[model samples]
Target: MDLGGNRRGVDMGPYAVRASGLYGMLKDLGHSVTDGGNIPVPVPEEIGVGA
Candidate 1:
């Protein structure tokens, strides 16, 4: 989460990491990679200010 930051699109970090072949790279190194998938988070519109 962006926390108190005013930046938008910071949430896209996860997507960028996955697109960078992180899982594939780990597996190639003999590491087990299991994707638990993204956790469900409410969008900004679904949350009220100060909530």
Candidate 2:
């Protein structure tokens, strides 16, 4: 969510990992993968400071 941070794009991490074939790689190693999906989080702009 990048709360209390100056940088951006931290929220894109999950998408990046999925695009890198993490699911397939783990499955190949005998692990069961389940896509729990993304949780809903409000952006900093939506909630405002100290919200």
Candidate 3:
């Protein structure tokens, strides 16, 4: 898969979610929920792009 350029944004999506306070918003909607926190995933450095 050739990821030409502009691939950095995809890697930061998860961090953006935490920054946006999604967990808190959902909890405020009067629904029981538990945020298990971020899942384990490898960064681009750890797993090099194979394009």
Top candidate (TM-score): 2
Score residue 36 of candidate 1 by CA lDDT: 75
For candidate 2, give the lDDT. 0.82
Each model's backbone clash number:
0, 0, 0
RMSD (Å) per prediction: 3.7, 3.5, 5.9
Candidate order by decreasing lDDT:
1, 2, 3
The superposed Cα distance between candidate 1 and the true structure at residue 35, in angstroms, equals 1.5
- The lDDT, on a scale of 0 to 1, for candidate 3 is 0.67
How well does each candidate superpose onto the true structure, as a TM-score? 0.56, 0.59, 0.44
Colliding pairs, model 1: none
Question: Per-residue lDDT of 1-51 in model 3, one digit per residue for the tens?
Answer: 214555657656657777898867878997786766666755567786783
The model with the greater lDDT, 2 or 3, is 2
Question: Which run of 10 residues does model 3 get worst, by summed lDDT?
Answer: 1-10
Model 2 — TM-score against the truth? 0.59
Residue pairs in clash, model 3? none
RMSD of 1: 3.7
Model 2 bad stretches (over 4 Å) = 4-7, 43-51
Give lDDT tens digits, candidate 2, residues 1-51: 556757798877778879999999999999999877888877657896777
